[model samples]
Structures are given as C-alpha cells and as structure tokens.
Target: MNIRKKVIFSFVILVAFIISISSLSMITTYHMKENSSFAKQVSRLINIQEDMNELINLVTIENSLEKLKNIKEKFISFENDFELLREDITKKDHKDLIDYILPNIRQNQNISKSLNNLFENEHAIELIFDDIYKFQNKHIYHNDLFSKIYPEENEKRKLLQELIFKTTNLKLIQEFGNLRYYSKETLYQHRDMETFQKWTNSIDEIILELRKNDRLKILPLFTGYKETVEIMGNLAINIHNIEKEEKILTTKLIKILKENRDESSSIEIKIEEVAEQFLSKISFIELILVITIILITIALTLYISSKLTSIIQKLNSGVKRLKDGDYSSTIVIKEDKEFSEIATTFNNMAQNIEEHQNTLEEKIKLRTNELQGALVNIQKQKDILENLSNKLAKYLSPQLFESIFSGKQDVQIESKRKYLTVFFSDIKGFTDITDSVETETLTEILNEYLDIMSTVAIKHGGTIDKYIGDSIMVFFGDPLSNGKAQDAISCMNMAIQMKEEMSKLRIKWQKDGISKPFHIRMGINSGYCTVGNFGSKNRLDYTIIGGVVNLASRLESNARPDQILISSETYTLIKDTIKCTKKEELQIKGIAHPIQTYEVISSGNNSTIIEEQTGFNLILDLNQIDKNNIINILKNTIIDVEKNI
Candidate 1:
C-alpha cells in the first residue's frame, strides 16, 4: 500500500479498538452499581422487620389495664414507628426493602388479630392474661405489682372487688368469678416485683407456648424479619462486599483507568514517537527525494551542458573551417533527439554549402570560359573587320572604310588623291533567266554567280564594292596599292578568265547532260577618282563616285557573255598587259554621253575566248537564225574548240 493509505488504515484500527474497550468498560461499571444498590436496600428492609418483632413480643406479656395501657401506649407508639418504618420502607422503593416490609406488615396484622382474639374469648383472654403473668414473672424480675399487694393496695383492689361483687349468677360466676378474682389477683401481683416476675415468666411461657403451637406463625414474621435482616445483613455485607467490590472495582477501575491512562499516555507517547519516526522517515524520504531530484537535475544539466558544449564546439569548428573557406566540414554529434536533428541539419547545411561552393566554382569556370570564348569571338570579329576594311579600301579607299567603322567623336570627309580602277559586271539576259528559273533557283544561282565573281575580283587585287542584281561593282588600287593600270589589267584578265572558266564549266555541264548554260559580262575602267566613305552620319557607303564608274557600269551592261568590256581609259592603261577587242560605243543609262568599250580577248599566253555573243544576243537573233542552223553552228564550234585544245 502507499504510505498515506497505510497510515490511515492503522489510525482507523486504533480508534476502533479504543472505542470497543471503552464501551465494554462503561457497561460493566453500570451493572456493578445497579446490583450493589439493590443489595443495600434489601438489607435495610430486613433490619426494620427485626425491630418490629422484638416490640410485638414485649407488648403481649404485659396485659394489666394499667400495664395494658402502658403496653397499648407503647404498642401505639410502636405502631406509629412501624407505620413510619413501613412508610420509610415503602418510600425506599428498593425491591429487597419492599420484600422485607410487606411480610412484616402481614405479621403485624397477624399479631393484631391475635390481640383481637384475646379480647373476644373470655377463657382465651383469661388464659392469655394468666399466661402473660407467668411469662412476665419468668422473664421479668425485680419488682412485681401483684406480689406485694396489701390493705393500702385495697382501694386499687376495690375496683377488682367491685367487679367480683357485681357477678350475676353463681353457677356462671363459679367458673369465671373465682378466675376473675384470681385474674385480678394475678393482674394486681403483675404490678409487684414477684408478680411482675411471675407475669414475665408467664408471658415467656405464653410466648414459648405460642411458639410451640405454631412455630411457623412467629417464623413467618421472625423468619421474614430474620431473612429480611439476614438479607439486609447480606445486603449490608453485599453492600459492604459491593463497597469492597466497588472499592476493589474502583481500585481495579482506577488501576484499569491508570492502566488505560498509562496505556493511553503510552499510546500517545508511542503515537508521538511513531509520528516522530514517521516524520523522520518522511523527512528522510523527502531528503532522498530531494537528493534524487537534485541529482537527476544535475545529471540532466551536466548532460545538456556537455551536449551543448560539444555541439557548440562542433559548430565552432565548423564555423572556423567555413571561415577558412573549407566548406567540407560535417557535424557528427549524437546527443539528444533535438540535438541529433540539429547535428543532422548542420551536416546537411555543410553538405549544401560544399555543394554550392562546388557549383559556384563550376559556374565561375563556365562564366570565365564563356567570357574567354566571347573575347576570342570578339578578336575573330575584329580580325574579320580588319579584313573587311582592307577589302573595302581596295574598292573605295582606305580612308572610306576607316571613316565608316571608326567611332570618332567627330568625323569629316575630304576627297583624297588616288588612282583607282573600278569594274562593273552584269549578267546578260538575266531578266530572261530569272523569268525562266524558280524563285529559289534564281536566288541560288544569283548568290553562286555573285560569290564566284566576287572571289575572282578579290583574287586579282580587286574589291567588290556592291552587287546590283546580276551585276557587280568592283574596285582596285586603294587597299592593295598596286599600279592602277596594272590593277585594271588584272581585273580585265580575271574577267576574261572567269568567262573562259564558265565556258569550260558549261561544256562540262553539257557533257554531263545539263541543258542550261551560265554566263557573265564585265566592264573595267581606270581613272583618277575620289574614293572614300560618303553618306549621312547614320548611313554610309564605301564606294567610288565619278563618271568613270558610271561609264564602266554602262559598258558592262552592253557587253555580251564571255566578254570583258573595258572603258577607253582602262584599255589605254592595260592594253599592253591584256588582249582586248574594240567592242562598241554604247549609249548607257544615266550617262550624258556615249563611252568607248572593249572586250577582253585573253590573258597572257592563254589566248582562248568563248563566243562574243551573249545569251541575250543569241535570243535577240533567234528570229534571224533557224533552230537547225544554230544547232549546226554550235556543234561545229564545239568540234573546232576541242581540236584546238
């Protein structure tokens, strides 16, 4: 059981035992007092009965009128006393006293009945008076009234003499008269010493006789008185015994009380002792509990402190490593649940930091590589720009491309002196070719032809200024500073070479079963011209602007395929280096006057030329020649060209 329950249970049992013992002790004490009071009352009633018996015996013996009066007076007093005693006994209300008094009253009534019987019977009265005289004389002594009778006592005797003289019948008087005289004499003597002695003896005889006749008659009163007295004595003894017993009981009670009190005191002391012991035990338990709690708290604190210190140390180490730029530290604390999670999180954070650090390095490397690649690309673009500048200078002039590309805060353009050769080429019957070809095929062919023509121009120290449909405007002698005359001759030679290359390519295509023929027309002009970048600020072009440039374009437009038409000035400069044929004076568009043109016949030591008529010329002459005649001429020309090669 728990301590509290145990204590409560013990306290309840102790209280129950005490109450049970106290109740039993109280009941025993009540019974003892009741029984003791009963015995005492019985004893007192018996003693009263004994006194009535003795007084009744004295009254019976003395029967003289005088003595009777005295006895009567005494009896009256005795009756009064008896009445008082009876009242006293009745008032007592004790069972033993009532028992003793009730029979005595009956006995006294019997005595009164005996006295009345004496008065009623003449012989009985005479016998009773005679017996009383003898009983008194035997038992009484000293002085007697009747024994010492004399002449002086005659007057007292005269009343008795007169009673004798007054007798009526002799025969009746014979049994009574002499007896009356003797009765009077005895009565007279009963007053004397001897007579009284004789009367006392005579009363004793009567009493003895009465006792002899019905012993139990007196016994009822005597026995009742005796029994009452004995009972009273027994009661007294019992009361005394009770008192002794009460004394003993009181002593025992006192002893018991003392014992109980001592026991109670002991119990109280024991209770106090037990309480003290319990308190001590409780205090010890509390101390133990406090100590245990303190220890547990201390242990918990130490454990937490150790864990916190360890965690903090690890965190500090991690922080130090992180400060030193090492993002690879891991926390491995295995403490409490929360701390474990924190450690795990710390490890995860470290891992994340390390991963991020690696990712940052990779990103930095990638960004650096991208920047380097961009720089390399920019450098390549710069090189390309430089090359483009050089090419543009060749066509327009160095000053022109520079002015266009340079980011000068302020820019001004002035004409510079330079000898330049400008060339312009156009495809013959290009409109017809475009109309016959698909748009995609036409663009493809145009880009291919332009790419080839531009390559040829550039190869010969020429620059392509622009492309105008199936035409190209080329220039020389500026970016690459060769002799203008030589540049013109070189341009002319490239144009002729281009025509011959195309014719051979066409022949190869014909042999390979291609039906379409490709062709180009070119015009070259050499002159003194202004070359630079020229335009508004936002827009510009690097080109030659002069009459010679326009005249060169017009000549190229009028030339036939496989023809290199040069201006008169260009022919004058390159006539010695390249072969040319005088072509025609052509009225050109956007020109105020006609200009002399020539066909570049051949390059040095390779005097080969395709047909002078372009595809446009052939188409124009289509109505003049039959299809069969044209086919026959083409076949014959192919045979002749093959034999010469």
Candidate 2:
C-alpha cells in the first residue's frame, strides 16, 4: 500500500483499540458500581444489626415504659435508613440481593414492634405489683394500730402480721426484675412463663390460707386484711397472664431476629460471590482484549515503520551526498509518487546548488564591500554617540540621559503638568562674601559649591533643573517618580545633606585664606507644576514653571541664613516624617495670597533661625540684584541701608 493507505490503516487499528479499551472500561465501571451498591447495603445492614443489639441492651438496663418509647424511636430511624439503602439499589444484581434482604428487614421491623409490646406489658405488670406491695404495707400499719388500741388482742395482731408477711407477693417483683436478657438468644431461652406461673401459684396459696383461717377473719382488722390479700392475689394472677403473653411475643421476636441474621449473612455471601464472579469475568476478557490490541498495534507499527524507513533511507542517502558536495548527481525514488516528487525537488536543489557555487566568489566580494561600508558608518555613528553622551552627561542626570538615549523619553519640547517637589537654595550674603574673595578663588568656590550640590541632588534621584548664579534649582518626580510624598521627602533629605556638606566646605574655604564664608539657605515645595523641555527649536530647557515654583523661590529668597524653608505644600507631605516648625507667612510677588511656610528644624541637625524680625516691612526691588555685579550692588545697598538708619 501507499503511505496514505498505510497511515489510514494504522489509524483505523488505533481507533479500534481505543474503542475496545473504552468498552472494557465501561463494563468494569458498571460492575464496580454494582459492587459499591452491594457494599452500601451491607453497611446499612450492619448499622441495623447494631441498633437491634442496642435495643436489647436498652430493655435489659431499663424495665420502664419510657425506655420502651425510646426503643420505638430508634427502630423507626433504623427502618428509614434501610429504606433509603433499598431505594439506592439500581442495578439488577444489586436489586436481587436487596430483594432477599428486604424481606428480612420487614420481618425485623415486625419483631421490633413485638418487642415493644413485650416491654409495655412488662412495665404494666411491674406497676401493678408495686401498687399491691404499697397496699400491703398500709394494711400492716392499720393492723398494728388496732392491736395497740385493743391490748387484749395484741398477741393475735402479732400472729396476723407474721401471716401477712409470709403470704405477700411483693418479693416476687424482685425475681421478675432479675429476668436478665441482653441478646436475642438470651431472650429466647429465658424461662419467663415458668417463673410467672410459680409466682401465681405462691399468691394462690396465700389467698387459700386467708380463706381457710377463721381466726384471721374474727380479728377487728380481718376484713381489711382479707381485702388486701384478695387484691394482691388478683394482681399476681394478672401479672402471670401478662408474663405469658410477653414471653410468647419475646420468643417470636427472637425467632424473627435469628431469621434476619441468617438472611443478612446469605445476602452478604451472595454479594461477595457476585462481585467475585463479575470481576473475574471482566478481568479475563480485559486481559485477552489488551493482548490482542497490543499484538495488532505492534504489527501495524512494524508495517508502517518498514514502509516509512525505506523512503526515509533513500532521502537520507541523497541528503548525505549533498552534504559531501556531490552537486552533479541527484537521487531518484520509484516506490511512490510522493517520494518521486521529493526526488525531483532534490534534483532541482542540486542544480541550484551547482549554480550558486559558480557565483559564490562574486557574492562574497559584493558582501565584503557592503560590510566595509557598514563598518565605516558604524564608526562615524560611534564618534557622534560619544560626543552626544559627553554633552548629555554635563546637561542631564545620568538616569534622565539614559532614558532619553534609550528612546524611552523623547527630546521634543513637550510639557505636562505634574506634582513635583521643587528645591531652591542660594548662598546667604553671597555678594558680601564675593567682595572679599579674588576672582579665581570665587570661581573655584562657586564651581565647588555647584559640584557638591549637584552630586547630592543626583544621589537623591533629583533632576538639577538649572543654576541661577549662586542659586540652584532642582526638582524631583519627573520622568520617574517614587511617588509625590517620597519625592518630597527625598528632596528634604538632600537639602539637609547639602547643608552639612557646605559646613565642611566653609571650613576648607576659610583654611584656604578666605576671611568670610557663605552659608546656604534652601526652600522646598511640592505641588502641581508644568515640567519638561521648553524653549526655541535651537535651544531647549528641561525645567519646571508654575506658581509652585515661584513659591519655592520666594521661600529661598526669604529664608534665614543656614535655614531650610519649605512651603506648606511640601510640609504637608513630609509632616509625619520630618520635624519642622511653622514659619511666618511671606507675601511673595506675582501671587494673590501670602504663602504659608515651615522652617525644617532638627530634620538632620540643628538648623538655626538666623533671619531676625525687622519689626518694619523692608520692601526692596529684587530686580536690582544683577547677575554680573551682584556683589558690588549688594555692598552698595548695605551702605545705603546703614545711612538710612
């Protein structure tokens, strides 16, 4: 057969095997379910057996009407459980097994009812005996009282008490109570009828004695004594009759229980036999079918493998020749049309391989020139990237530069409104200090200050937006944000660290022969502001602008020397984390309202309150602070202020 027919035949055989396995599994499942049902019924039967035994026990321990009532309730529950099990039997074999057990269940129910009757009758007999005993005791008391009142007949009263004690059947109730029965067999063998009859005879003898003795009748209490004897004797006979009936009923109940026990045993045996028979039959067939399927599968596998291997070997041989550079010859297969087409394709591939070999040198030369051109372009791009990287490092933070270079952030002058923590700090009395320092020393001091502040900003993940002469502007929560609160906290921490570093720088500058050292003041604010690259097409500035930014600058301009001032917005975000004292409000320019500020005290160190209250408002045109000649102008202002005072 061709490959298609071979594959089809193999598939058909596999499908047949799967169907066989499925059919076997279904048959096994059916038998398993049948066995499970049988087991369930047996389990229920066992429970009923335990209940019956418990009933017998209840009767033994209690000889009262109440215990008998409890026995009826328990028996009803047992019947319900058995009925449920019977309804659960759905399989034919399981139903047949239950058919045998159900009859016994019914019989057991009847037996339980009969036992209940026996218990009731026993209770009634005990009650009557109790009443007779109580009456006998009352009569003896009256007799004694009569004898005491009439002293002449005291000896006769004593003899009457003896006769009464000897004839009473009160002690017979103890014998009835001793009728021990703990199981069905014990109940069956008990001599209850004989015991009741002997009790009746003893009472009859007492009644005969009472009738024959005339002396007993002549006593003053003779009528009462005779009435008591008659009542006791009658109750004894009634108990004896009831005893006979209870014995008969108990015997029948025991008979039914035994039959039920036997029937239960038979059903269990039948279930075992049925389960064993079904399993053995199914297992035998399963084994045979499995062996047959294995054999068929192996035969088909060998047949298909042989056919496929022949074509594969031919194709493999041609592949090996191609691998060995034999491009002049091709393989030809004749077994099947499919193999023939493969051979044809293989031959065409060999012709193409030969033609490709002829132009291989020219292709290599062309590829070499292309690779050289790519290398030259790569070198030029590398040089351009190096220059760009160096320039970016000076202008942007390493993180922001990487983001822009990696194409994650664009270089376009696009801006967006975001909440950022803006920081502004400047050297206190910078102009006054600059006047005492040389130009070169001042340049050195300024560069050192900028470098130190910038280092702290980058370390705290802040972006240094710009430097305005002796002032620095930095903001966080842009391009990447650790959240607004975190950014504000980080900015505050950076400001604290910069203050500490500046103290050391001041000491170094003083040691380098500078007489006056400048202290830094910082201001921070956290609020919504527009931040991005914004400028002309030729030049762009990545900075933030808004009222919030202005507020930060105003806080810096108004801050006391060596103090860090934060706007209310920044203080609100870091209030729980940073310790700060509220500062007086400042009326900032270009704003409608006076802004609330807080001086960050004891955040990291002792931040002094150096800016004193002037008691009078001193308004100065801040525009007079020139970028180029701020020191000379600031000195002139100090002289003019002294003159005004």
Question: How far out, in Å, is residue 557 in model 1?
Answer: 2.0
Instruction: Give candidate 2's total backbone clashes.
Output: 0
TM-score of 2: 0.43
Q: How would you encode candidate 2's per-residue C-alpha lDDT over 1-645 as one tens digit per residue?
A: 677888787889778877887777673564466556556765565566556555544443344455455665675565566556544542232234443422222223333343344334434433433433333334344434433433333343355445455444454333222321111112233324454444334444444544565434434454444344333334434444445544554565565556555555655665566666555655777788889888988988898788778888988988898889898777877777788898999999998998998799799999999999999999999999899889768877776787888898888889999999999999988988777788998999899989998999999999888888999999999878999898998998898878777877876776797766678988888899998889988888778899889888888889888899998888889887788998898888898888888988655333332221323212222334454585687689889989999
Q: Pick the candidate with the highest TM-score.
A: 2
Q: Please identify model 2 stretches exceeding 4 Å from their true place.
A: 1-323, 326-355, 372-376, 379-383, 406-408, 604-645
Model 2, residue 629: distance off in Å is 48
Q: Write the per-residue lDDT of candidate 1 for residues 1-645, one digit (tens) a residue.
A: 433354456556556655654554463344334434433433333333333334434534443446644654554454455445445434544344433422222223332343233223322222333344444443323133223333334443344334323433343234334433433444333323333334234323433444554533333332232222222222222222322332332343233333333333332343334234323523544465556556655655575466567768977887788779776676676544555677678777877877778789889999999999999999999999888777766554333345356753134444455788887767667787667677976776677666666667667767667777777777887655667667777777777667755665566544554356767777777887787667877766656788777777767767777667777888888777677788768777777778777777776545342442333222113335577987899899889979999
lDDT of each: 0.54, 0.67
**What is the lDDT for 23 in model 2?**
77
* Candidate that scores best on lDDT: 2
